[model samples]
Target: MPGKHVRFSRNTHFQSPPTPALSFSSISPASSYAPLTPPVIPNNYLPGPSPYTIGYAPIPKAPTIRVHPVLEYSSHQNVDFDILNHPSSITKNRRLLSSLVLSEPATSTPLRSMVITCPHLPWIITVYPQSGSHITVYDVFYEIYRSLHKSITSSDFASLPSDSARRASTRAYEQRYSRHRSSRHRDEEKRSGMLRIDFLMGMTRFAGLSPTGRGPDVWQLNIR
Candidate 1:
């Protein structure tokens, strides 16, 4: 311990042994030299955009509404349109309308339902036979009308199956109803509007008040 020594001098640098005293390999300039470099990436910059196109996936448009061929299939007697098709009159079955002249077929099943709404109007009709019960027979009329109304209000008649006879029938039914519906709305407004005025006057009378005079006892016209 007395002979052991260490030195620090401004003029001389301390050197490591040629290789670490514990290892056999010789030290070389390549092994000893290292540069104090900063890290590979700094925090400020963001990653660049990807090579793949930056955009929304092109939205595929919905396929154009397709209308199928207006097909007339005399439904099997026992199924689908059975109860609705068969009514009490055997002679009045579709054979009557089927026998009518200047008739043609339509392209769609729904369109076929449009034909036979009016008795007076010219039509190439296909009849829906009715059930035996009185209640059901009456209901057939209502159901037919409801079906027609729904068909008219629904999207487009272009999709209806094409049949010359069927189309003509549908046209007649639609034409008759168009006139009827227009007049019906006009009549309703006339009736309801007058009834509303009558109701207001009745209320005023019951309350023992007149609209012309003022006060809590007098009726006030609340024109909304």
Candidate 2:
């Protein structure tokens, strides 16, 4: 065999130049002078209306409320006695009283009345309107009978002594020996000027100031 032809093939591949390492310190001061730009917002994105803008105002709306019928004066006077017996009706009575006093006026007559029965016995309280926004409780009497039509004294009067007189008798009894009790009695005497009864329910201020609520025999109406 002829001597094998020895041939050596030359390796021909292009070699790229080595890249330079980049750093903040390595960057020139002049090259850093270029401004940093904000990130580009996507094409589909949009800013919403501002809260302070008039165009974004809240829609006006009338409240959807079940307006309960105004409790008429007739219905009010004819209150069930069972409601007075039950403690749950206190809240209802409060609400009704407030609504009647504030929203619905006693327009028909010069005087208007409603009854709320005491737990055990029937007591009639007479209220008189004073010059100031105050009510003076003239008298409170215990009733003998539950009669609505007949006069308070004729059929129902039981002649109970006034609260003030009872209070005075108690105070006098207490101040017999104690000097402190005597001083307190004097203070109480000064404080016992007028029985200013103020009934505040919700926003209603039950001051004896209305003409319809004034006048004599206002307490004749059966509350219970």
Candidate 3:
């Protein structure tokens, strides 16, 4: 390319854009900005009192045990209680026996079974009334008392239910046989001490008026 004119400087220095100067103003005395310090939680410092109110739920208490009522029932028929006087007089059929005092009323129809057990006797007298008759008839069952040699105090005996009467009877039995006490007998008594009566159907059968089994004609009373 012809006729091109070019101009050059003798200073020989690289040209660059000039940077603008920066200015800083003095911090205001009234300004809130200050050096960072740890957060100041009132009432809280090293080994100092805490601000939070800590608490816990209360613990639950155990349930109280239930005590059963005393047995107070009356026998209407004047049957001879002595086994010697009447051998076959234990069962009372059509006996109009009614409970004088009951914790709960007879919820269903009247159905009662009487069991007469004595501490001194070796036999249990059970009177089952014939349906619709309620007269006295007797049956003697072999009394198989668990040989437990533990005597309960009169105080304890009075508070306990008739179901616990067996325990008392067993204790009485143990006392009578205490004269011939031996190590073997003591061990056996200790083992049998834990045994208790399974059921106590007072004045009435616990399972009153219900179909008992696979028989159509058979029925039972679910009385507790």
Using lDDT as the measure, the top candidate is 3
Q: lDDT per residue, candidate 2, 52-164, as tens digits? A: 84444455543221111222224332222221112113233434323223222222222233332222224444332222222211111111111211122212222224545
Instruction: Report the lDDT tens digits of candidate 3 across residue range 41-152.
Output: 6775466578999775555532221111112122332222221112222233434222222112221222244344433323333333332222121111111112111233
Candidate 1 lDDT, tens digit per residue, 1-224?
15422111122122211111110111122223245585687779767978887555554542221111111112222112211122222122244222111022211111212222221112222323232211111222223322322222112323334445334434333333333357876443333211111111122111111122222111221211
Q: What local lDDT score does residue 45 receive in model 2, on the 0 to 100 scale?
A: 93
lDDT of each: 0.25, 0.25, 0.29
Model 2 lDDT, full chain set: 0.25
Q: lDDT at 221 for candidate 3?
A: 21
* TM-scores of the candidates in the order shown: 0.18, 0.18, 0.18
How accurate locally is residue 69 in candidate 3, as Cα lDDT from 0 to 100?
Answer: 16
**Which rank order by lDDT, best down to worst?**
3, 2, 1
Error of 2 at 95 (Å): 5.3
